[model samples]
Target: MQFTLDDEPRFPRGKRSGIGIIGCGHIVQTAHLPAYEKYGLNIVGVYDISEQAMRTVQQRFHVRHAFASVDDLFASSDIEVVDIATHPAERAGLILKALQAGKHVLSQKPFALDMHTAQELIQEAERRHLTLAVNQNGRWAPPWRITTQLVQQGAIGEVLAVTHLFDTRFEWVTGTVFDTIPHWAIYDYGLHWIDSIHCWLADTPLTSIRAREYRTPDQPMESKADWGMWCEFVYANGAHAMIRSVGCSQTQRDGHPFWLHGTQGIIRGSILGKGNDFVELERDGISSRYPLKGQWFPDGFAGTMGELLCAIEEDREPYHSARHTLRSLQMTLAACQSAEHNGEVVPYEEMKR
Candidate 1:
């Protein structure tokens, strides 16, 4: 259950990235805190909107400072970066405040409520000469990471289409704060898969998207959103990526798998969720199998932080910076709009508002 990196230091005492954490929610406890510990990063302090939550996190994680106010956390000279784990509603303001104070920020996604807010945050970060990283950690899932590398290496001559299929009951919603999230399955959880496709097909720009969200009567009407969702994404190169997932199916267990077809080869695999998964590439009647190591939970979390560390040291943007992940946000919002509009085929360009 624990995934922290090392009891021994990887760098000299003063050399690791100095991080000030700005949220103490579920993800911070499960993923971010453990990943930071594993990387041997220097955590300067911790803060939360709730005074009690802030104090609890400090004690639980052995954090150095339990900041009295958001401004107090921002003013820390030892804090060179802010790792923001707040919800989308609050994330933009926190990112803006941190950038204005001259601190690099790594934020959770859906990076913003909408694309315009995301752009505003990105622009301010650029103006301040600070890196604004989007924690699209799901891209580091072993199956996804390997497949992306394989396609880039031309192991697949030319991609034709991609299909991602997932079926699982979001039973975890029964007693958690996520139980209250509107469109909990698609808007909240589905963003992970949508963002992954953007990364898996980095070369092709998505041009069109049509989507729908639905729920059967048995599903809890916790919010005004659906438990089952579908989307078809089209690229400028005439390629298509389709996503079909159901999180409220009373007849199904959990499954996460993907299929990718190319002119010269075919790829099929499942993400780390099922534990027993494989990536098989078939070409010219020959089959090759690649096994994956590390689950997405903490490993992907570690990868996100590691990229930011490298970006800081090399004076460059992380591969999935806030500006870079704007594509994912735009696509996700299009899906939402399409579902609301009765599955109308919405050109991705129509979302530019």
Candidate 2:
């Protein structure tokens, strides 16, 4: 059988409004600006604590204005949306300010450092009647996106289990600011996987989660973040999911395989960003491969902003809204808490506590 799926990123078709970026960090320089430029989105201005950083991005992207402070950016009537790409420590405050200024917001991943703070931000956005979306761009990654669409479309009847493994070197964090994050492996780098698991099984009742973080003797790390971790999710309906990461590998193996087992069929694929990424399905003893387009880097970035804009235009909740991501944040935070307790199971109800 031949199949077609809406797997590509989409931009808002009506009244593409001005977006002001709050941080001009590496991600903005590399992914956000480039993707926005490519998709023809209007960036009215940008601001960063460092003037040099702000000027560099402003000159590079030819932005209309580079604000001297975030207050100025918030005051500008040209901007209706704010992209808060600041680190988690300072992100919540900026989000609140943006919402109070009557602007929609698109937050970076790992939405907030804690559940209470994330919830507060979500509620504040709701009170202000503005769009607040998290940048869980992995949901738009080609392979994972297709998998979710297939499951939602009932191509795979009743998801039973999801298994994902990542075996790759993570030398980038060494001697960098990223290594300083607590549970950096799971929270900072592995957050996309956790968010993806939550997205696919959102309707299912999650019972508890167990996770562990480990360090290997051969691992090269100068910080507290271990290079390895594994997390398991238990569901009330007997369906479950597992996500594992091996960040110390000298070489990536098997494209970081993943399998989704459902009652009717099995969908298997490797995560994106690795070379030779692919997805396949099996049913009635027949196997078929689905050809995918686009990579995660810039496309996923575009998808997040696009969905937010679309939601704003249509007056509906974006698929990656902050309210929806609260559950994702709970699971990830619980994983970190569970790791501290030596892989003890943490119940979903107790996540807030």
Query: In order, what is each prediction's RMSD in angstroms?
Result: 4.5, 1.4
After superposition, the stretches of candidate 2 with alpha carbons farther than 4 Å from their true spots are: 1-4, 221-223, 252-254
| lDDT per residue (tens digit) for residues 1-353 in model 2 | 44557668887777898999999999999999998998899999999999999999999999989998999999999999999999998998999999999999999987688888888898999998999999998888888888888888877789999998886776667788887888987788878888888987889999999999998677664656687899999999999999888777676453567899999899988765457677888987998888787777788899899999999998999999999888888999899999999999999888876
The TM-score obtained by model 1 is 0.91
Worst 10 residues of 2 by lDDT: 247-256
Give the alpha-carbon lDDT of every model: 0.79, 0.87
What local lDDT score does residue 107 receive in model 1, on the 0 to 100 scale? 93
Tens-digit lDDT string for candidate 1 (247-331): 6655433568898899888888887455555677888888888767666777788778777877888888888898888888888
* Among all candidates shown, the one with the greatest TM-score: 2
Model 1: runs farther than 4 Å from truth? 1-14, 221-224, 249-253
